[model samples]
Target: MISSVERVRAAYARIAQVDRPEVWIGLRPQEDVEADAASVDARAASGERLPLAGTVFAVKGNIDVAGLPTTAGCPSYAYRPEADAPVVARLRAAGAVVLGTTNLDQFATGLVGTRSPYGAVRNALDPAYVSGGSSSGSAVAVALGIADFALGTDTAGSGRVPAAFNGIVGLKPTRGLVPVEGVVPACASLDCVTVFARTLPEAERALALMAAPSGRELPALEQRRPGPWRIAVPRPERLGELEEGWAEAFGSAAARLAEAGAELLEVDPTPFIEAAAMLYEGAFVAERYTAVGTFVDGHAGSADLDPTVAGIISRARDVPAHRFYADLERLSALRTRALTALGDTDALLLPTTPGHPTLADVEADPLGANARLGRFTNSTNLFDLAAVAVPAGEVNGLPFGVMVIGQAFTDERLVRIAGLLAAPPVRLVVVGAHLSGQPLNGQLLSLGGRLVRTTTTASAYRLYALETVPPKPGLVRAEEGGAAIEAEVWQLPPEGLGALVAALPRPMALGSVELADGSFVTGFLCEPAALDGAREITSYGGWRAALPSLAALPSPAALPSLVRTEGPGLSPPRT
Candidate 1:
């Protein structure tokens, strides 16, 4: 493990090397940050299991840090909180050093990063593009290698949009899940504390820490909804607004998900689209106004305030109370329809944003372009859904992404789906001792191997009883006469397969094995030389059947001391 003090210094060094000054609004003194890191190292050295030890994180400025002023991107409205937000406190307790507060759209108002008074947060990939907001700085921080993860609030795509732009993982968890008590809410009721990380597992790790009960800890292995997943996607007709390469990019992403074992189903995009419009076009702005409009109004005409943010909030003051109720009623109905459309589907997959917009694109028509960025994101919080956005592929040379939105409490489901999307599971064929309930089955079990199913190899291999220590079988391709041989198909992560390969004993190796179904998989195979003087057990069809032949056999080469003769009672060789 890296020392936390070194991690802290490395993060500061990265921040200094990056050109985007707007990515951070306030950075805690390096010495102070290093002191916190040293403490984490001390605890870890003393035998404490600090999950986040040596990890660095950045907090969105809207969320309060004990010493840094909560600017919410408006300097005049800044306030120094005496204590860290409950969410921040939880992360700190877990041993993550708070590097500093990052920039965001003022009061988390816009999807476009340009609304911040500090300056537009530039995309880490290419400065010409807008770093999506109001979580822009947080995403950029992770993308720039400054922090392992960063905390951002998501009311409407604030967490996810920036992640797409920066090619990172953004997790906007179930609403009301992460405590938002100390966050400067954009739409208080809809806001969720989200995390931006370079990868999904890291985001899951950090968010798991924040969302676990005060006393109820998260399980070591998260519960995952297994695939083949039933996934829903928007109807093609409704995607007219996607930029030139985005539609194709999304199509490719969906195709890849299908290949990863997700069953794709098309759903009308109407309900979700309409709900998204309501976030800004309907009465939801009333929530935003209620959240921070008072301050914006009081500081009216101040050049320090972002005018677009002021105007957006200012207009909500005219919305009748009845209008807010009516919209709520409308949203209630839309949630039902949206959920219904997504019925039985493990997740709803969509482009993270319609397109990647340039910094100039936002500058030219800030409101319009910003609204478009939330086209697929706004309805998420409104519908009370959990979402995980991950880098998909590039479009027109710019990074593109897809979001897997799932029902509340399906955060782990999204994680699973995203993981498959990131790295498809590998199939491995196991035979002989590696079969379920067999002597060496525990090896695969300890490697996180999942049984896909029991099957048989093609009628082209011969099974032989090798005179090895444990009396193992050697499977070899028959020159002419052969029959199907029983084997089990297993699934494993790519890394697990690699580990298994590296640990295989001599004479046993992995090679292409044809299945009875005309399919091929990487499976356990033995060198032909191993069967030179071995007893052919081909008629038995499988190792399990041939085991009866070795019922009275001793572990000759393995343990000569324990070898028994005709003497009846002896610790029999493991069957």
Candidate 2:
């Protein structure tokens, strides 16, 4: 088993190997990490509970950490804080150690990660590629395994874009879910604290700890199998700036979901797109200026802020008071439109980044590029949704992620669903009463089972309605004349097989079952000669439907329901 401390150490080594991404101005001293590790070890020996227990993480420079300087990526505005921000305090109490502060678009102004004065954070996988920002450093740190997780702020796509580009998980919790007390404001109304991690489980654990612990009971986490998943896609007319290859990747991902039993529903994503436009194009850009205008003006002579960031923040100084009110009114109406568009879907899937841009690519059109980066992300906080970015696939080896946005407060449910959708694991085909929603399903569900694509085994096995204590289905491999049977493949952790096998009823056992793809898995295999006058239920493609429907026909109880179909078992087809 891999320990979190070992994971953190590997990440630190990777961060030390390369020149650190220009996204950070400094790092925690080596002596500090050593001391922290010692304390963690002592606690482990003493059996004291440590919530995070040696997990290493980073904070965006703008959020204060005791004894560290708060620069917000702008040196002129740097100030040492006497205490950790509230969010940091909570995480530290949970046993997470802060490694250092990361660089960002100065004052968290730009969406593109390149506007920082320290140095542009390069993509973790490919150096030439620009790391998405203003959460650039945090995303890179997690992507390169520098920390188990890191904290960043998402005013626009700062939290999400970087995760998409670097092949990591970025979670933007509902605004106000994690209080923003002590963090610098970058459009405070829409600003949200974000977390970046390599895996959904790790990210989700951290999210639970960081969320403001409330006494109110949250709904039980919902876990719907992959089939029946309904996703609302962007209206074809609203997709903008998607690169050629990216368009194909999105389509292919959707196709994969369909294969896994999901229903892809296309809805007009125009209202959300229209709301996204309001973030920067309306008065919200002025809010960015409001947060840091005085500093920019006071330090005009000494500040080395990116000229482009400075230019946009300066726009705040020119907005007429009345126009601000008018913009607010329009925004309210747009929010309603957004809610209607998102209704009736598990999540609204969108390209993490419409497209990727390079350092040189962004420098040429900083403003235009930054605006484009937020095309799909700007409305997240504006409309108030919790989202997680997962690595969907790749284009030319660079990562492309999909954002699963759900209604606010359903954050936990979203994470559970995201875990199910992660890359498929070892398949375990079940050919009997163990199907989902069946009595034996509790056994599989207890073992962290995830439904993989559901399908029937090739016609080469025999099924016998086994007469057992609870009445079960017996699937057995047969020679030349076996009929193809119905079954569903599920994924489970390799270590969890023992418990499942131990719970099997007598007569009906676990063995290899051949799937349509000629693959095999641990599934239902029956005893020999169990089939006598058993009525075949081969017409129904799956065990659940076939068995129940067969019960209704003639022998209902007398007619043993047996069919020549693939019997559930975990054995590769005889090739």
Candidate 3:
């Protein structure tokens, strides 16, 4: 595998020569990137770990990554920040090194990436095609694998449209799930930090790391599993400005969902669409002006900013305060209608972007093309929903993806579903608390799952003491015939198993192992080899009883609130 650092250096080498098309507004020094690479190498050699170790990533110009200037794609508006935004801080903590800040529509005002004065960020797949913006370069960076993932701000599809245009995964997390403290907001209430990654897993990994704690408790993982999920689809008449092949691909995808046992329900998305319009078409545009009004006013004569972007900001100055508040009220009402449309559904399915437009086409009709791209994305923050875009198929040699939208705080659920949608299904047996109704069982259920059987491992395994803080037992398959250990079988939906697997701690993994009934289930297998000289505890059965008792375990009140760091067995909420 190419280390993310190597990929960044490779991209830099290519970008250094005629960097115009990729459009980096805030390129980092080659020396800084090399130093980060050295750090990654040192950490790996020293046995220090990182979930995103050696991974290279980028952020849209609006986000504050320490040492990078916050330009929002306008040179006159640029300013160096003293600290990384919370999202960037989190990613750094997880071991991902920043590549550089990318180009975007000035002040993130345009959906098409061409509005930047630095240079238009071209589509990664083809220079002739437009990279959707205002987070265009962020999307292209990930699409071309220059970075493992890129951070973009989504206040009107700046985060999502570009991913679709570039053929990558765009994760527009639930608004507020990722904080916006350091972002140059296009619409403060609707602005969300989004992630772009080549794969759903990579995107989810980045989301988990960057998401801040919301302080609200999540519904137990098992409780989140709606028994039979309803997946909402827009009524055919409502699919707007769609490309030819997108309709076919979406229909085929829906059929696959039906075949896979989802209850596909057709819904009138007019209310949702109406709500989406509130973002830009209504007074919400005033929020955009509010985000950077002072700067725009101070630099009124700057030729560096895009004229269209400056015009939009200038127009916002005329809106009265009452109109902005009225828009907020209207948006609230629309949110209620939108939520009703998604009621009881596990996810609402739609095309990631209505269609892709070429650079020439976007340049010819900027505003019209931009509005067309937001057809599916404008309502996310307005309705407080979490969403992820997973690649589905292709059209005219360009990749197309499906957007899975779910209720807020259901980010993990969407990821699990996205993973299933992305990869082929696998059958595996689970043991211990992973079984239905068990403490850690929700992880499986959230992915649309069910119990296959209650079984046992083959008579060649010894369960032992593993160093989990809530110390757990690990089963080691032995060549010499050993005692049959108890376990359970699970029938997981094709994309339903990731949320749980992704939560496992270090030294634990999903492995092929025998069951008590002389069968195999993809169950929890431990690196008991890491438990050398540790106590053998197979006689007490599984971790539930063999491990320490919950009664004697420290009460929530007694224990210091240890942030559930990302890894296996931890499902800490993303902010």
Candidate 4:
């Protein structure tokens, strides 16, 4: 394995070789990145497990990273944060090192990556093509291998569109699952932290580390037991606006899914389209205004603001509060109707974007092209859904992608489906301390493990509360009496399996464990002798439920605050 310090050096070397200034707003000094890598290395040397120990990542400029100036793609609006965004902080704690902040559409107001004052981020595959935005640089950074994965914000299609254009995976998590505490809001209520990575597993891993504690009960995810899935697609007429060859490309992808046992059902897209239109055509625009209206209005005609962004915010000022409320009520009705229309379907499959636009194309019809890009995506967050965009194939030598979407909290299900559609990796089932938000979960994450879904083990094993310092679990196969115990299935890189197995403590060992659905996979198991003095807790069903004390641990988002005393000293623009 490459050391973290060497990985950081290689990333810097790649950046120097590419010399793409437009892809970054402000980068951390090389020495700083090396220093971070050294710290990670020291931790590893001391036997501390780091899930993302050698991982390099970049953050969208709108997200604060303590010492860096957050420009949000507008130089004049830059501000130095006293601490890292909750999402960034979580990633760092998981062993990922931040390279720097990448560029985006100014204030994250546009889908076209071209609206930034720092310069339009060009497509990683082709310079003439426009990098999809407002998360432009973050996607480009990952696609170009300058970073292993990058953080992006998705209010509309900012995250997915870029992943499509760059032939990568973009995981737009459910809103509030990943906190937006230190991120500059584009649409405060709709904004979500998104992950961009070359592989689906990598993106999913990042998503797991950043998930926040949701206070309310969320919808249950679609079952993971492999069988036939009913996937919904828009009617032919609804796809009529696709660019040349794109419709054909989409059809081929659907056909591939069918071959993989998916039943494609065409549905009316009216409700979805209406919900999408409501984002800009209805009072939702006021939310954008609510985020930055005061600042833009105070600086009216300043040269610092992008003209398109200024115009969009200016139009929101005239929308009366009553009108906003009316639209909100209308949206509520549409959302209910849309959910009803999608009844019981496993997932909705759609093109990530209607087409890939060129820099010249965006210049010719900026707003129109940008709006088209959001046709299938703008309604996702509005409808309270989760989506994962994966590269389907190429169309006319340009990258194209299909998005897998489901109701909110189905993020892991969507990611699992996406992995199945692409290339399935080795899966490992974890029972106790290795689950997300657990004390020892970092060990799995550092080894490139991603949570697939939380399910139960076959009713043939007994779970025991081991007498350990941090309280671990011991699972033993029982022939006569056993109960299905809650467990989380995770995808792990095959290369890391040996190391993971070798590092297991006394009671735990790698063995085949059957899932509730009778599917078997390599997982953690315990020798019967190890459970001699342990308390049998199979009645509790899962480790989490059995240990009430674990509930008091702070969530990933609520970890200790890190206060930085030094920054780039960029003055905040006067309003």
Candidate 3 displacement at residue 177 in angstroms:
1.8
lDDT of 1: 0.82
Task: Report how far residue 124 has shifted in candidate 3, in Å.
Answer: 0.9
**lDDT for each of the candidates?**
0.82, 0.73, 0.73, 0.82
Cα-based TM-score, every candidate: 0.72, 0.71, 0.71, 0.73
Q: What is the C-alpha RMSD of each candidate to the true structure, in Å?
A: 16.5, 16.1, 14.8, 15.6
For candidate 4, lDDT tens digit of each residue in 76-150? Answer: 778999999999999999889999999899899888899987898998767889889999999999877678899
Model 3 lDDT-worst window of ten: 554-563
For 274-384, candidate 2 gives per-residue lDDT tens digits of: 778878788768888789998887766564777877877887788778878997788788878876776667877788778888888898888888778888898888877
- Name the runs in model 1 displaced over 4 angstroms: 214-227, 424-575
Per-residue CA lDDT of model 3 for 69-94, tens digit only, reads 99888887778999999999889877
Error of model 4, residue 178, in angstroms: 0.7
Runs with alpha carbons beyond 4 Å of true place in candidate 4: 220-227, 424-575
Worst 10 residues of 4 by lDDT: 561-570
Best by TM-score: 4
Q: Which stretches of candidate 2 lie over 4 Å from their true place?
A: 1-9, 214-227, 235-237, 301-303, 424-575
